[model samples]
Target: MCEEATVSLADVVQEDEQLQEEASAVLAGSDSERCSYPQGYVKRQALYACNTCTPKGGQAAGVCLACSYKCHEGHQLFELYTKRNFRCDCGNGKFADAPCKLFHAKDDVNGLNKYSHNFFGEYCTCRRPYPDPEDQEDDEMIQCVLCEDWLHGRHLGCDVPDHVESWEMICEACMNTHAFLWRYAARLAGKRRENVLRDLTDPPASDPVPGAAVESDAAKETTADETDGATEPSRKRVCPEEAEAKPGCGLEALQNAGAERPGSGAVFWPPGWRSRLCRCDACQASLAAAGLSFLPDESDTVLAYEKKGRSEEGGAPGHDPLMSALDNLSRVQQLEIIHGYNDMKSELKDFLQGFVAEGKVVTSADIRQFFERQQSRKRRRADDRFHCA
Candidate 1:
């Protein structure tokens, strides 16, 4: 459905009572899938699962959403899902209304929290945990779109565009490889842009070599400026031929990192970028030795799914829900202990096998009255025995 179907406030209130009554029956054994809620214990709604109660060898059991905080709050949860076709088990023998075990969300039961890089409790190039509220306050971390690694604001240097609103961000390695195309993409147009992204890549004229020598005139002016406390006007530029042929430099080999040489005619940027992040042999060797890449994947952060995917909306507003909170007594035991079970079950089975039976409404209060009457009879019998003696 598109929008949330608006529900009437009065109708919801009416349903609330029926919902509880129906839910109680389901927990008591009307629903075959659930054992019934233990007698005398009424429960709230069902919308969350408790991974802590998962049997060592059996299926996981669930309680109501409120029970998460009310009962199993500190216990590791199964990332909360809608309790479809199931009943709440709170206050039942299985759940027994245990107090929630958690003091904080971050202190999840083992494997309870989503796992990924964050499982190690550290992220990004800075190797810090996502800023915890318990620790001192800190800056927000930005995730790189291409590599999917998180980084603090200061570590990424000053290359990210200040006005980036639509386009995704890449790591330094990817930006270096695709900088040429990103800069002059409109100028390159169709085939030329592809070619540039693929092969015959140009060296960045803008980047300065770490240790290139300066011309004598420029060096002389620099010394004079230092002595006079004046600044030099401009620096000399290296011609294209000299840069391309810089002894150990390999402008031609960069084509392999970026594109097919001639007949093969395959593109390389995206694929190359991924292999490099995975530390494939060619990418590792090329990047490690030469500080460059072919190109990188637009979305390299596949690990996000394992961590964030579980936390998506667990349930939505709906007219119907599930509840089944029952005890696990043997049939003979239930027969001996619960005089009303047989009667309740027979009536429960007739309504399309659902929980709500006709006429009688059984809530926790009814069970309380039944026990009170039994105790009252016991006291009267003791008075009669004393008089006879």
Candidate 2:
């Protein structure tokens, strides 16, 4: 059995806040409009800083690279230069209201946040940032369609162990898309398709394993160009009630979709999509019984309608309608959670990137180990603080 992880109150609040803020960002368009991105994504700059936040120290501007994600999340931030020598402004000047939330060592190792930082200026075989007038080459650097980062011909695809064997690369930001899609496709006709996926990262094996649906992140990524990540949905987002009304979520409908088609007898919808795309009460109960969670539909149409509905109708005043549940969701399950269980999975995945990104035999043990590692990290961090103090 998978290590059981459940949701708690704190998790719900955090996710609610995040969802509301994201909704606000989408509806009102915060500083996001002025934000410059790597085509479809955002690139970090050492000089980038957010003027928001209630100056913890006395600082309002000049935020440092180390404290950006923590200090500037959901804020309108701007970028300046690429100075490498400038020190972090986290605890100095008007910013001294409190210690840096990211790094506890105020003086050691320059107190920086490197965990999520993208430390790249340029990429490709040429090794220069894009639009270099000095190079004058028409051949361009490969820009990843997922993360939108420019990549070197050899160093593309994923960051650590990602299969970097192709120019049409889909970065890690969207690697999960293919995993979920594979699962859906496998159950499409209620049959497991053998070797439906091929690994793009590794050289071809003479006699590969038969019926292998998952290859690796690199293999899953071959389907990324046509698929969308959790944040980017290609279909209309509907309520859970709406989803059950369709096929897949309901067992009978699922069987119907899988029923034999005489030269395409029935127009079958993709399997598991009913649950994957719904957020209604009925779908919530169904997924709960199956030990799964709701991955809310985030299509623009859905977001817009929700924003409008919330504005006009308001939330359940006294009921506090149960807002779905998620545990150690299958990686192939695209339901993105916000806190506790949702966040626990993310933290664990971050810790065990190597394990999570391995070839497609991700088992319940893999999921259990992921959670165990998270507990170990937390305990280790607490121990270090006690020893240092």
lDDT (C-alpha, whole model) for all candidates: 0.37, 0.37
lDDT of 1 at 221: 24
Report model 1's TM-score to 2 decimal places. 0.24
Task: Report the lDDT tens digits of candidate 1 across residue range 145-241.
Answer: 4344456555665333332221233545445554432322222212312232222223254322211221223223222322334433443455445
TM-score of each: 0.24, 0.24
Estimate the Cα RMSD of every predicted model relative to the unseen true structure.
23.6, 27.2
For model 1, what is the C-alpha lDDT against the true structure? 0.37
Error of 2 at 309 (Å): 23
Residue 102 lDDT in candidate 2: 56
